[model samples]
Target: MKQDQKPSVVLITGGSSGIGKSIGTFLAAKGFTVYGTSRNPSKFENFEPFPLLQLDVADTYSIEAAVAIIEKQHGRLDILINNAGAGIMGAVEEVPNDEILKNFTTNYFGPIEVTKAVLPLMRKQKQGLIINITSIAGYMGLPYRGIYSASKAALEITTEAWRMELKPFNIEMTNVAPGDFATNIAAGRYHAPVRKGSPYATSYQNILSLIDNHVDDGNDPQEMAKAVYKIIQTKKPKIHYKVGQFMQKFSIVLKRILPDKVYERLLMNHYKIK
Candidate 1:
């Protein structure tokens, strides 16, 4: 494709529902050709109206197939949004090693594989944007969400490193750390186990109650879609973005500034698990 003839192409993973769907829909509305990748095409609401490509982030073969299909049609991808991840809710002790692997496979390694496949195309084109839908939990840990938090935290750190590494290649990496947005994350949350002799079983239930209440008042998905659009459109977007409740923004900052012990105690007291 010629320099001026190429159109903006957005390939989003986990685009069938929730935040990923919102981002894909918003991008589509902007006149960008959007391709949503999901494991189940049924999860894709309207492919006729838009476009959906079957993709499974946890599987390398699926990611390759999705990218191959996109490359065949578009030749070059301008935007890659790694939005495929789910929350695994369980105490670290209760959660089995296999479950931990499952969490990271989707949240961390899945994106890594997709990015690897697309990076070559972007490098050849000499321009592209990779947006990661990291969570506020990545910046600040939460009780009874240790696995989910760990996965997101890993993604966050890797995004930072990739940002620098990809900058020299003229590729951009943006990590959007959104505070709790109203989504199916809670409903779809994977509950595995509490480790042997774990004392967190009762405490986990308390955290679930808090989550149930907060999801009711979480930020609208549209707000996040708009934020995503802004990040993608900006010539030089911030490497890290935090959106949602002002209180969350403040708390994340506080954690950064305070001592480790201070933050740990604050979290403990905040959740009343002590």
Candidate 2:
């Protein structure tokens, strides 16, 4: 950020589209050397804002190769944004075990593996920042989005412990829990079918539509980009940062003060679950 200083090099997973793409583009505009990862870079031939490397977060070999490329080109990786994740929706009883595992693979384990790959570089540098992009849904379980909530909540809590561990290395770690943003996540989310005559059919179908509508009406991803930029400029970043609409953020505060059943009732009422 200083005139004589070298620009910071940044690596963002899941950067090919959605929130990741927005962050890369924003930081690139601000003079950060940015690289974004996609499972398949060849498919995004028109991607021009930043280079997209072929790296599937779920694959360790792919992650190592991508980090290697960044280290080769820049010689120092300064910031790692673990933004790669997927969404899953279903009734707890109806969603198959495999689907739940698949969601955790992408939304939970994927970020951890990516963080592990980048830590060596950051440790060597002796100064770095790792921002984990999580979700506000992580704070509380939404009726039909329990799996998605659990995956994000896992990352949210994991970052807290990791932040303390990384303190001695001067490598900062934080979680950014964002509320719904207008993106392709809804289309990509794995949804368990609402089978006819199944006990959860009507409720699940109704909640699914509500979930999609929330995403469709969500805020811009650029808001998240700005939040990330702010965190990067801070002298000492906190363990957690949240970006979203007022009520969405307030819900987290309410949960802290309200009784357990009261909070549960609030959520059930919001989702119209009897």
Candidate 3:
């Protein structure tokens, strides 16, 4: 390796657009060998300056292949950001079993599988950082976006466990809990089996409007990317970091101290359900 060369390599999933793309681009500009992934890479090749790998986080074979490509090409992976995830919005009872499974497959299990695939390389290197992009909702379940919250919450718990377990290997893990950002994430939200005359229709519609407005007026994806860049540079990064609007990020702390009913009312008020 050259004396002044950028030797670090980073692999980010779901990096075709939005938050993932922003992080990949930001890190690449800083001289890291960044590889962004999507289920389809050629579609985004012209749009992005850096390399984009074809990866479907939900598929085991695709994940294994993507990691193999990165390891074979770079010979080392310094960072792995599990930023591939999607949201699902539907009443708990109304959401079909398969729909819930699909949501978890993408949001929860995908990261786990990707991390498992990359651990060997990081382990061989004996030092690496794995940052999972959970959500502010992971700390507290949202009104209509319950499954999204649940999946993120599951990821959060798993991250904590992995962090402790990976310490001996010098493999670090962190959870980045982001609030609604100005991205195309809403377009990918799964609103499955939502019936017109369902009892939760009014609440769902109202909550959806609130969610849209929040995201429309939210922070940029670059903000998240910058925060993550700092995390990458930190020598002792914290186990969890929250990024988003002030209130959204603060809500996590509030949930811990506030009474259950009080917190419930605050959530209802925020969603304008009452």
Candidate 4:
């Protein structure tokens, strides 16, 4: 963690695809000892792969075991990227309560659980960076993305508390807030609130149509990975890094500048949702 010494052991969660995979590919190419985790790494094929550790961030036991393996092999961890998350889309009222809780557990609590397991070592070493892959949802509200927004919003709060607490120990917390990224999020999402007789059923179809368009315009994961690497090497990494289209930055700025009603209307108008 010293200015002259660099930490080479990097461990990333959800490194099988999208942003996580891109970060792994980029960092490994830069000579970092990359240890990426996948719930099902077998899905990766024909690609230059990083040394993988089996971890499902949603499972604390899996996270612990992966960290143990990393510690035993590498002796120290220089970076921790909390990139494991799921896209759960639906209105809060329509989504099954259990599904909402489960999504929150995976998207919000999972990162904290993994971080808790790794922090003792990071603090003891007094020099490590923790990067969280949050979304623009953390800053702006959107229709039908209630669960996803709430989850990232929770992390945004956690990051703030953690930033102050960890900085004193020479560890830093950086949140990556990306906008529409070219990923299979919408395509890969699992909906637990699909009920034909449910009142929100018709609205759900409309939401899905909107999401299809959003996914069509997402950013490349590699671009996000490169940004993360820069954050790692930079001397002063901020508390948050925003990626994606200019709208991503514009949204954040508007959130800061606009009144509550104005922002809410803008959000509704942006998605053409009531």
Candidate 5:
């Protein structure tokens, strides 16, 4: 590489911490010019090897402004990682409309808008990679976290369509469906307001405990970051890359081979939902 040649520029949303932060720092250390986004940059104290830009994926203005900042400084973006997302926990029927909307806005719409904002630049370059950080939940809707699961599933489908649609322009797109990973997600996960006498109240609590435990015992964020680094280096990445524990990664495969009832039963048993 020529010394005068600039490093590839990468923009990862919701990157102040957890998976996003790890990915940003890892790629930066590998010589890419990485920028991670947070809702409030002032709140982030550490982002070694990269810088933080203020961005709220839910807001169009914030998304546009952040992209502009990158364009001004970097001139072109080589990669866009849509890792910013939020979750809402509740039974599908019990979750409020607002809560479901909130989940979709952050986990689905946010990434869609971010991709739209970055596409023009990518198209002009005639080459770029868009990696949407979805989840294993996207493949199968969990008991209480239906909204989150649905939102990710939606993003995954959009990415599939984008991959084909953008092929002419040489824009590559894929979904990284990670199973549970040890991160600050558990600390920030949102739950629905459960009424004392509501039938779902007790069940919700029990199920949440199980999910929390699973997350606590999940894979390392840095491990996931390393996976993303490899995906970036590859000449042509797959449509979907599932990363997690052996069973979690295999779950996606089982879902394909087993009958619907069989898969759901397995999922319910694993989550202790029944």
Candidate 6:
């Protein structure tokens, strides 16, 4: 951000609200040129700080068109924030296959496709950064959130491989896994119905309430925005970064050091599952 230098251009997918919106506003305030994307841009007509572009990560043509517009306007794209995602909650035994696939389409494949669309621009620029917003849940399989966990975990691992491949090009890639944030993710997340007399009905209902409350009391989205800003300023960013509350972030470390069954017991106990 020197006097002679142009502000870096950043594109954040799913930018209309929640964490994406916060990040865009934060970066814009810091003098970075920011553009946020939504599946339907017209709905966010009054969005401030940065303009919203119409981009559905799940649609290849939409992804390409959005990137094309940015390239035309800015001439160079410096950062891509893969933040668009959806959540799914259900028992592995009960969640429909199509629902699982749909979740993956939004949370896993969507980000990957968007990254693919942006890579050529980054490569041509010979310098760029791609930050994939993963989740702390991705580190382990939570009972009702298995699909959501798997989708994020997939992105986390994929980013590791992508980082190595992009090394020679001076382009960088990384994953930032966030824990529960006070976002509207719960409202948007797909939930398999708690069928009457189903074996998991009681426990599933209990955990569902727990999950919503956790999100309701989660950290501010600005915390994530600051973390992203820090990563962008890093000369050689790490393959992975995590942002969340103390115990939430520590949960990953516990999983690494604790016995498998012991960790499972701890998780079940916290969820009040038998």
Residue pairs clashing, model 1: 93-195, 94-193, 94-194, 94-195
- Collision pairs in model 2: none
- The C-alpha TM-scores of every prediction are 0.93, 0.98, 0.96, 0.93, 0.95, 0.98
The sequence of per-residue lDDT tens digits that candidate 6 reaches over residues 109-181 is: 9999999999998889888889999999999999999999999999999998988999899889999999999
Q: Which scores better on TM-score, 3 or 5?
A: 3
- For all candidates in order, the CA lDDT equals 0.84, 0.92, 0.88, 0.83, 0.88, 0.93
Q: What would the per-residue lDDT of candidate 3 be over residues 176-241, giving only the tens digit for each residue?
A: 999989999888888855578899888887777778788788899999999999998888789899
Q: Which segments of model 2 are wrong by more than 4 Å?
A: 1-4
User: Candidate 4: which pairs clash?
Assistant: 181-218, 181-219, 182-218, 182-219
lDDT of 4 by residue, 54-154 (tens): 88877888999999998888678888999988888877787888888888887889999999999998888777889998998878677788778889989
Worst 10 residues of 5 by lDDT: 1-10
User: Which residues of candidate 3, in runs, are more than 4 Å off?
Assistant: 1-5
lDDT of 5 by residue, 1-274 (tens): 1112678899999988889988998988888899999998888675465889889988899889999999998779989999998867988888889888888999998999999999999898778999999999899888898888899999999888889999999888988988888888988888877779888888788888888898889889998899998888888889999889998888888989999999899877876666
**What's every prediction's RMSD, in angstroms?**
2.5, 1.3, 2.1, 2.0, 2.0, 1.4
Question: Better model by TM-score, 2 or 3?
Answer: 2
Per-residue C-alpha lDDT of model 2 across residues 154-254, encoded as one tens digit per residue:
99999999899999998899999999999999878899998989999998999988989999999999999999999999878888888999999999999
Model 6 stretches astray by more than 4 angstroms: 1-4
User: lDDT of model 1 at residue 254?
Assistant: 92
**Residue 150, model 3: Cα distance from true site in angstroms:** 0.4
Which model, 4 or 5, shows the larger lDDT? 5
lDDT of 2 at 25: 99
Please give the lDDT score for candidate 6: 0.93
